[model samples]
Target: MRVFAPLLALGLMASAAHAQCGGPFPAFVKGLKSEAVAAGHKQATVDAFFSGVQQDPKVLKADRAQGVFQKPFIEFSRRLISKQRLDKGRAMAKKYDATFKRIERDYGVSRGVLLAFWAFETDFGGFQGDFNTLNALTTLAHDCRRPELFRPQIFAALTLYEHGDFDPARTTGAWAGEIGMVQMLPRDILINGVDGDGDGHVRLKTSAPDALMSGAKMLSHLGWRAGEPWLQEVTVPADLDWSLTGPGQNLTVADWAKRGVRPREGKLAQGGLPASIILPQGRKGPAFIAYPNFNVYFEWNQSFTYVLTAAYFANRLEGSAIYDAGTPEPGLDGPQMKRLQQKLAARGYDVGKIDGILGAGTRAAVQAEQKRLGLPADAWPTMALLNRL
Candidate 1:
């Protein structure tokens, strides 16, 4: 890993870029001021919030690099469940069980999942990013790629500043402008911020209780079910079509069992809880039937590993009986993955680029190829499939 850049340099470079870009930013700021004024923010509120903002080239680069928005699920998961990570998660769970329990009681989100998100987002609050929060949000807003998303964050940050929820000058966070242990964006800070510590102020930056509680609050709002695990790894009866794993269908646990789907961890009772199956890395990798709560993780980050990692980390934290049972599939690395992408595209797969990333688009193309070859249509791109490529 490369050494991190100095946060102050990042702060300065960002502010200068936007002020000098001269791309109707004045109009954007004017429109923003009008919006704030219309929303009942005082003139001082708009001026104080947007005062030092500037376009940031670095943030633009980061935004551009997020193109196609997908990564292999397993590959993303390994880093999350590493031994060090698991050990840390366990410690956090045990040390903060009471906190987790409180959140669970109030929000229906288990301590495990909440703690898991806590561990993953900021290493259990070990290091929140160090950019001036307003500057970072403004930088991200100036980024053209996804301005719609980041612009609201800019507004949200300003609102938070106006309301005194955070002092924009003192607050620092990720380049993407997420704050606290769970990396909450400014909008989430607006809507989902909760005073878990009951300090009369929902301070996500310094208060662990506030951050964790707010994190769980976000999950709860997204449909967390009390006492239900997100979903379980299951054994599908031989000959079941594995390709039917994704977000579209919801099957009852019992309904799945009847169709030859059984929890890999022995027989689960016939509770007809709605579920969806996700087959990441295709049929060759592990599969899971996701429950309603699983979708909550998706709300935070729309990646398979992100959702499953939160769940698996939660299980680890909770001392749940099972964690990840999925075996590591040998998938190609950057160069080899690009080679495979090129070959697939040449063979009419229509993968967008020869980038080594096996995003959903690449996975879909891989699935199409497997279907044509009469292989499992699960769309898992592994070395096994790559050999054929």
Candidate 2:
């Protein structure tokens, strides 16, 4: 039997759509109801799932206001993996040792990796967001930006509700509609849910074991290789070809060694595993040789900074030393990055959008500009580069 949270009185917050997108949110939801029924969800289930659902302007606001992806890797990683978070993550690993052992045995995922993901996702379950999952998903689905992604999540949530995964009345989570300790989206839960406690049901909200195990299952399905290093901090020689850096360039540890790449604080292990040298903040900041398992982090989160932070946090949990390579130099902030991107595009470098993110396209363009300027072409954006732009 599912134990539902105390029901809050339903009240409609005035839609901010009129001020923003002028979307007919209620009518969109009505169409979703018909679509849900057509997609084989019972009418009663559809109605119940959407009961008291509202257009969460805050959710839409957050969706449109995602600027963190533009943050430099050093700042982003520091914020996500603080000393307090690391200590608490270690404690949690000890507290849940047996459960983690079982999870590793069953799913072949590292305990540290799982704990790092959990800590990063929800602060060790300190607080999952309070937004109603149904309303958030509905609003996002109705919003024109990315309906193709959120619409499927809505169906998955409805299916979870229909099957009693959680009480629909209490289905609250992040504004993006990700739920529970590790913040899995509804579709992820539907596909990778696991009864980690052997309770014959997967309840992520109240069960750390269930959530961690389910997350592990998902990671494994996403190609997480057990006992493989995700990334290793390394020092790259100044004269080495800068084009060899980034995810696209794959080489063995031996090949990297031959190119003057060495472990920052330790000896590189002898292996033939192909790895990519990633200079997250260009050559001025830390460099890391990312292994095959690092790709799984991309599968977990598309943001380059986010995946690096998670992988680095996991390494810290396993007692790895902090990175000893170059420090992040003063660099361009979001607006400056946007200006630089525009400059690069005007120069016919195709830096994608002037969205302020130093993604691959923007970075590549920065490299091209550096080469044209007769500067070291490390592909990292600096305030100096922005000023030149």
Candidate 3:
């Protein structure tokens, strides 16, 4: 379930109601440079870097795709863990066993979680997003929606250039300016980026270890307990309180036990872990009693469902208990999802495609769908809606 993280003011992208382009680009670019100067960037650094840069509409479009699809919890978990990816991750795990173990030993994050992050972010380092990081971030900064967030990224991307990670021509990544296997933003890289390979300079431009280790460092900073499990897949009480699901609301593991929420596999831990159970599909779906570590994963992307997927994938990579939540409620099944897609398309929605695969695209469509149905379409697809469809 996507518990909206209070609608951040940063990173808002283009919407269907408006299209922004051209003529006003230079003014926007100058605005970012001015803000960068205010934020302690050298004026020349900002000027030379952004003077000739232009807004990338494609990057803006990609940002729009951020939460376009919504999938079943199991399918979303499966989406990032095909057999080949898992095999490659295992191979990396063993090949880099010494390195990863050393990282885990030093940092307290598990090797499996490390590799799962590796797999999740870049598909074992196969397809990091391709875009000029400097140009992309500058464009995003100039776009008016997230100038504050992306402006610093633009400055930092320039810093990466001055530091010799890559010339401007070579540096590129996800439209959001996140590079490498872990998809970190330029600002994140500036603060948390590491030099894992001992290559004199810490660089994510070409080093997987740098990226992976840096990601671990970020997660660790976000409060991942060295040996603590991010979450426990569990059978939440049938009558579990809905009000206490998100952060701030809490329960002791012992209190949860008193309420009969047990670990889906082994014995649930005692009340030491602060936790809450989330019903992603409302009722009749898998439940996870998440801890602080889960919040660490959420720090990467503020989606409850994404956190569950990351933790679940971490479990699969680790040989831990797999969530067996019986059957999903009849929410958005294949055919139903397709119809929703078509409905979205007919209504002039761009949900990537009505391919019947619920993903970021479908989620956007569902949010649009919910708005149409006058439902609280935070874009979470549950099984009950499937039967109704």
Candidate 4:
């Protein structure tokens, strides 16, 4: 789930009779209420759900100011993965061993993967955010920036309300409206929620079994392989063809071994699983060969650095060694990154926004440019590469 600063202000406004997405906050909420009724919700139910829900300026501010993802992989990973978290994750794994076993058997999702998300999302349920989920969803839906994504979640939450699984005023979660321990959106819970504890209710906030089983089901639906490895650190040949790296350039493990790519520990994956070498910080830093299972991680979170950290954390939980942090060069700062994005956009590379964040689209464009300029196409943009462009 996307982290945000704690709620700073809870602002409320009078509701309007008209419908809109942006403009007067009341009108946008009115529009949402109408939409909910049009989608078959009872008017009373819609009213109750929208009652006391107000536009939270803090949620909007938090949504627009998500700069935490800008950190490089090493720094980001080191910051998130700590010894206490590791110990807690292992203890939770042991505590919920039976549930985890059932989830893995039925859903193909590993315990470490689920535990990693659990630890990261809410510190194993120590704190599941304090934002009122309905208000957060409505406030985000009222904003035009990403209304299409958050608007539907509002109605899904209404469904939960009707099913007696949600409380419009009492339910609390992340600023982005994800609820419970693993911080799933309402729509995801509607589609993949499981009553794992046999308590007849999918209480993700209170029931660890419910949260883990539901998360595993969601991951399985997202194409998680039953018993396949997701990521493995590997040593690449100094003269390896870096242009052949990145996500789309997958090759068999046998082929990679032929090119002198060997695992840092253990043997390769049967020499048949298709994998790609990813240089998160260029060839000078740590390298990992990502298997097809790793692609499922993108379905969970879009931030490449976050996904890599999470996947690597899962690998570590499964007894993998700590990745070797090599002496890699520093990345571009905000202004430099924006300038590079502008240059790439000028060259017809759709880098999404000129926001100075090295997102997936920008990374892909950088790799293409690097290949075109006869530089190492490891997809990690550097100053020299930027200067050449």
Task: Compose the digit string of candidate 3's lDDT tens values, residues 153-213.
Answer: 5656667656766456676677777777777776566667788889867677578788778
Structural similarity to truth (TM-score) of each candidate: 0.81, 0.89, 0.76, 0.93
TM-score: model 2 vs. ground truth:
0.89
What would the per-residue lDDT of candidate 1 be over residues 1-389, giving only the tens digit for each residue?
A: 00111111210122222332225766767766666666667888778777776655665565456522245665566655677877887787777777778887887777777777777778878888777777666665555544555656666777677677877678887777788888888777777789877778888878888888888877676667777778567655547675565665677777777787767665564467788767765544666778777776666775545666667667656554543445646666777788779889888877776767665567778877777777777766767677787
- Give lDDT tens digits, candidate 4, residues 141-180: 7887766567667777888899899999999999999999
Candidate 2 vs candidate 4: which has greater lDDT?
Answer: 4
Overall lDDT per candidate, in order of appearance: 0.68, 0.79, 0.66, 0.86
* Candidate closest to the true structure, highest lDDT: 4
Please give the lDDT score at residue 313 for candidate 1. 60
Better of 2 and 4 by TM-score: 4
Q: Record all residue pairs in model 2 with backbone atoms less than 3 Å apart, i.e. clashing.
A: none
Query: Which regions of candidate 3 are displaced past 4 Å?
Result: 1-23, 31-48, 237-248, 332-389
**Candidate 1 error regions (>4 Å):** 1-27, 65-75, 266-270, 321-329, 335-356, 382-389
Model 3 Cα shift for residue 315 (angstroms)? 0.8
Q: Report the C-alpha displacement of residue 377, candidate 1, in angstroms.
A: 0.9
Worst 10 residues of 3 by lDDT: 1-10
